[model samples]
Target: MIKEQGLSVQHVCQSMSIGPTAVRRWVEQYDSEQAGQPGIGKPLTPEQQRIRQLEQENRQLRGDVEILKKGVGLLCPRAEMSFRLIDELQTKAIPVSQSCRVLGVSRSGFYEAKRRAAAPVVCKASVHLRAAFVASHQSYGSRRMVAELSNRGIAAGRFKVRRLMRQAGLKPVWKRKFIHTTDSKHDLPIAANVLARQFNPAAPNKAYVSDITYVRTGAGWLYLAVVIDLFSRKVVGWAMAPSMPAKLVCDALHMAVQQRRPGEGLIVHSDRGSQYASAQYQAKLASHGFICSMSRKGNCWDNAVAERFFLNLKMERVWQREYANHAEAKIDIAAYIVGFYNSERLHSVLGNLSPSVYERNMAAKKPIVVSEFT
Candidate 1:
C-alpha cells in the first residue's frame, strides 16, 4: 500500500493494524533487497530468502562434517578412553547426546562414565591400596589396609578394600606357630606374676613386658630382646646380640630405662627364663627400683603380648629373607622395628594405630609423666 498508493508510513501502519516502526523497517528492508544489498532479519525478497536458507544449510553441513571428523578421530579400541574423550568434548561445549550418537556409543554408557569420573575414589582407592600393600611389605590385610587408607584421608570400608586387594591379587603373609625360647628350669628364685594378665596399662611407663626371640642367620642364631610398654604396645627398647644371656636382657632393660625413665615400682614383667632369674638381670631391676614380675612356668599365654610381637616380627620380616650374618639380621630387624613396626605397622589391639603413633596420640591427649630414677 505504501508503494502503489503512495500512503504515508503512519497511514499504512493504521490500515494494516501494525506499528509505525514495523512499517518503516519493512520499507527499508524492501528498498535494500530491491537494491541488491543485504538486510537484517528475514529477507523481503524470495532470492535473498533462498540465499539465507542455503547459508544456514551450509553451516549445518559444516557442523555435521566437523562432528563426524572428531568422532572418527576419537574412536578407540577401548570404550573407556572413548568415553573420556567424549567427556572432554562435552566440557568444551560439544553436545553429549550428539557426540555419543556420532561415536556409536550409548548415552547411558557415557553417563555412567561421567558418574565414575566425578567420584575419583573408586579409581584412586585401588591404586592407593596396591601401593600401601607393597609398602607394608605385603603384610597388611584388608582391615589394616582400610586403616591405612583412612590415615591417608581416603574413606574406605573393609569390604571395599578387600575387594580391591583381591582384584590386585594382593595376599598378606600368614602367621606361623610360635616357638618357645624360655628356659625356667633353674634354681634361681622367681618373682610373682604381679601383672597377672594385665596386658593393657592405663598410663604410659606403668607396666612393661619383655621377651627374647631368636632369628636364624647363615652365621648361626641372632637373639633379639624387646621391652614393650603395655600402654601403647610400643617397643620402647630393643637389643640384638649373638647370645641370649643375662647381659642381653639387661642391655635391653637398660635401653628401656634410659628411654622411658620410669619411676620406682614400675612393674617389669617377663617370662621365667633363666636370664630373667639371673642375678645380673634381677640386680639391674632392683637398682632402678623397678618391681620384677615373672610369667608363670610353661605358659606362653601369660606373656602373650610379647610372644605376639615376636610372632609378627618373624612372619612379616624375619622369615621373608635369609640374612648372611648377625649384622645383616640386626640391621634388617632394627629397620622392621623402628622404621616399619614402630612407625607404620598397624596393631588391632592399639585401635589400628602403629605403636609410635599410638604413643604420640596418647601423649597429645594428655600430659606425659616423666619419672626420676631411684
Candidate 2:
C-alpha cells in the first residue's frame, strides 16, 4: 500500500505515527519496495529539515485546534494529538527525543502534552477515516466513504463523513461535459433498440453493452471498445487500438464471450455505429447466439448506460493523462479498468459496492428485483 501511494519513508512515518527505522523495516517486506526504484535525492540540510518539520507540525496543530473549534466539544485537541502521537511512536520503539525533534515538538512541553484526558471520538475517528479515504485513491465520496470506514470497523455517520471530507478539502472525481461519438449515419443494417434503455439487468451477463471511446495519445488517438455487464456494470472485456474499426468491437466481444460465456439470447447492445452494425461485428455476436440491439440513429440516450461507463473511464482515469503513444494509453487504461475500477472503485448505482462484489452478492441471493440495489 505504501509503494502504491508512492510516499517517501519520512511521510510514511508521519502518516502512521511510526519511526523512520520502523517504516523501513515494515516496507522492506513489500516486493515492490525492496526492488529499489530510483528515489528523489534532494538532500535537506539540518536547518532546512528542521524548517520542514516545523511546517508539518504547524499544519497538524492548526488542524487539531480547528477541529476542536468545530463544535466537536474538545478542549486542546492539539495537545491531545501531540500526546497520542508520542504514545504511538513510543509503542513502535521510537525514542521521545528523536520523535520530538522530527515532529518539531518542544521537550519542555512534553509533560503538559501528556495530560491524562479522554480524547474526542470525532478526532480519533478522523485520523483512521482519513487513512481509509487515502487508501481508496480519493475516489469515494461520503456515502461510499462511510461504507468503507464501516468495513474497517470505524463507525461514522454519513453526515459526519461528509463534514469531515469537506473539512479535509477532499472531493470525489467528477464527470466532464459530454460528447457523442456514435457514427449512425452509415448505410448499414441496424437492429431495433430491443434493450430500450433498460439498464438494470436481473443477473450478470443477461444484458451487455458495448461502446467505443477514444483517448488522445501523443502519436495520435487511441480508441477503446468495452463490453460491460449491465447487472453489475463490470467491464467484462475491452480492446484498445490505434483506430476504431469493426475489428475492435469484434475483439472486445470475443474476449467478453470467452470470459463470461453468457448464455444464448443474451442481449448485446450498442449504438448504431457502422462498426457495430457491420457484418463482421454482427457475425461474431450471432456466432455466440447474442441478440444484437442497436440504439436508434441520432439517439445516444438509448445506450445511456454504455455512455456512462465511457464517461467514468474518461473522468476517473483517461482525462487526466497525456499518453505518449497507443501502447502507453493501452497499458494505462487496461490497468485502470482491471486493477482499480472493476475490483475496488465503488459505484453508487451498485449500492456503494464494487461491481465484482455486487455480482458475487447477487449470485448468492439470486433474487430478481427490478431495482437490484434498492
**For candidate 2, what is the lDDT?**
0.78
List residue ranges in candidate 2 displaced over 4 A.
1-120, 135-137, 175-180, 366-374
For residue 217, give model 2's deviation from the true position in Å. 1.7
Say which candidate scores most in TM-score: 1
Go through the candidates in order and give the clash count of each. Answer: 0, 0
Cα lDDT, model 1, residue 12: 77
Worst lDDT 10-window in candidate 1 = 35-44
Cα RMSD for predicted model 1: 10.7
Candidate 2 lDDT tens digits, 1-374 = 77787889998778779789867766655543233322233345777667767877898988876664453324435755665677788999999897565555676677654542332455577887778776665666788888887776777889998888888888867757554566777888979889988999777778999999888889997788999999899999899888787999999988988787677878999988889989999888777777999887778798888888787778777776789998989898999898878998788899888898888787778764332210
lDDT of 1 at 107: 91
Q: Can you write out model 1's per-residue Cα lDDT over 93-199, one digit (the tens) per residue?
A: 99988878677788999888777667656658998898899888878899889889988878788888899899889998875755567888889999999999998
All models, RMSD in angstroms: 10.7, 28.6
